[model samples]
Target: MAERVWEPGDRLPSRAQIGQEYGVGENVVRRAQELLISQGVLEGRAGSGTYVAEPRERVRVVRSSARQRVRVVRSSAREQPSGSPFRADMNAVGRRGVWESRTAAKVPAPAEIAARLGITEGELCVRTTYEFLADGKPVQLSASWEPYDLIAGSLVVLPEGGPHAWAGVVNRMAAIGVTVSHAVEQPEPRMATAEEASLLGIQKAALVTHIRRTYYSDQGRPVETADIVVPAAHCEIVYEIPINR
Candidate 1:
């Protein structure tokens, strides 16, 4: 193994040489080499043979529930002072802080999204798009969809350049006599689409992490469903589990 740490792009010794050096059978040497190749630690070229692979950048994972606390501010330019949206102080924090912004749109949900949200095709949903940034760089984009009937009268439009806080929104809704019970999240990985690449500032070759979360009201009715897309390089997802004895 020590001898196998060849420089990136450097050809590895032939199987015969490896077997002779390690005093192992040819089949044993071949099996060992094959295992390494499968792990991305080695690269094999058709004619050039196997070589050491260059180390790739490590992806950082951040759990949404583990987000750092941020100060909230009220947005200006409210038509009604009572309906002003809350904003966060961007200048007071560094790039590590997650800055969120939201906008509402009326659109048809995609098939996969609709299935996840348990909605019928062509159903009109109130789409809430969230842009999550770190140090002014967009790291993720999420779109939440809810049956318009549920949130139509309760929707509060944010002022220009307002900050986004999901917890705050939940709290406000509760104050209005709406009870939120729990949230469920489903996650997976997929290749980034062209539009996703443009929005996330990542290359098409990079993969993206997709998470769909549904929030249910206390009455066991689904209230909101969100689809979150994050660049593999900039973010990570973590889950904590506890065992009961």
Candidate 2:
């Protein structure tokens, strides 16, 4: 029947008819039909006989799941995507980058946040949230936390306030004689959470790139930590690793 004696969508012979044609019992023919259906060579519809399936619409699906991972990486930039929605590479020829930030002083850190910052749970920390804009439209969100003990009386503690306002962590820490030695990053891809979706104005469950980072002082003390999120479909990441001889 598959040798072109029948047309596309043609119905195959019944189990009994096929059994007689091949000199086999109906049960044997039934098994072959079942296999064909599973392979998409044939399709069965309720209240109708099986027919040749539309193979052009063939699809193969495979899935696997494992525990989520958190990797310690060398680089950590809140705006890592060189070509993100708010970054320069993604802007149309002449658009400029813009951002709005809100900082909360002495916010109690959550347990998980405390652990990352190497402080006891509920310790006070400075928390800052930012929305990156491209032509006045938001495209990314980031939140950062720094333990109060690290910058208690420093003018740069407020993140976006004081003399060194709007300066990055590396520079701000320098104002207090704290040299930021390095940073560690853990990046992952996942669906947007409800709060993230609402703030980014994207649909729930939309795929996003979430990166968590921790900055350390030269003395190995965690100085800052941050969570940066961007729409996955709109961002592309490029990594540049230096090889030492």
Candidate 3:
């Protein structure tokens, strides 16, 4: 790719052929191709072949602690028509941002999620899964969980279907009288799972950034927890912290 030997959209030779040409094992060629694909240098087409990918700008995800908001931002001045922060972010970058979400109530919390939310396993919680897209291309995924008891009998119980529908976690919790103090996020690099790869249109085992985020109230009580996933090749995460004088 550096030398333009394989131009954008140009199909690469078969693994066997590449291995023979370089006098390496086919497994080596396959591994190298996978790495390049994960880095956005190449893309694999099922039942077709691997091809050099077009240059793409990474989406910027801005997490601002000063305002207690997580949003995507770009330098452009255009504004989105919708009220969603994600849409505003896409509009800034000259793309359309849309998402599909499904919410399930009374879902049993798994061990890991229970730990994050400070609840015991088998506790009932409301879970919402989101698939976010930019310009019709999948870019991110999120699974959010909140204890049922926290907002029981409230209008914000169904995150996407209530009066406060589509309102962010902070706003929703605030409406229920929970003053969200802050959020903590831990990010780690890992390989993608089969389900994630299919949903994001990436190769299985591709590199990705996984984040575990939890929102806490003024009393340090966990109100909500979420797992966010971003394709490493398609997005960049930025943290903006405010320094008090």
Which candidate ranks first by lDDT, i.e. highest? 3
Instruction: Give me the candidate number with maximum TM-score.
Output: 3
Name model 2 segments beyond 4 Å from true.
1-95
Cα lDDT tens digits, model 1, 1-245, are 55545788798888888888888988997777655654445656678777887765433444433232333435575232222111222232333435465655456777866776677767767676777666667767877777665555553333122332244445544644767666678889877788887787655535678887787777877767887787765565565443459
Where's the lowest-lDDT run of ten residues in candidate 1? Answer: 80-89
Cα lDDT listed for each candidate: 0.60, 0.68, 0.84
Model 3 ranges off by over 4 Å: 1-4, 66-85
Q: What are the RMSD figures for all models against the true structure?
A: 7.9, 13.3, 4.5
Error of 2 at 176 (Å): 0.7
lDDT of 3 by residue, 117-228 (tens): 8999999999999999998899999999999999879988998876676557877887789988888999999999999999998778888999999989999989999999
| Selected candidate, larger TM-score, 1 vs 3 | 3
Better model by TM-score, 2 or 3?
3
Q: Distance from true position, residue 6, model 1, in Å?
A: 9.8
TM-score of candidate 1 against the unseen true structure = 0.57
Worst 10 residues of 2 by lDDT: 58-67
> What order do you get sorting by lDDT, best first?
3, 2, 1
Winner by lDDT between candidate 2 and candidate 1: 2
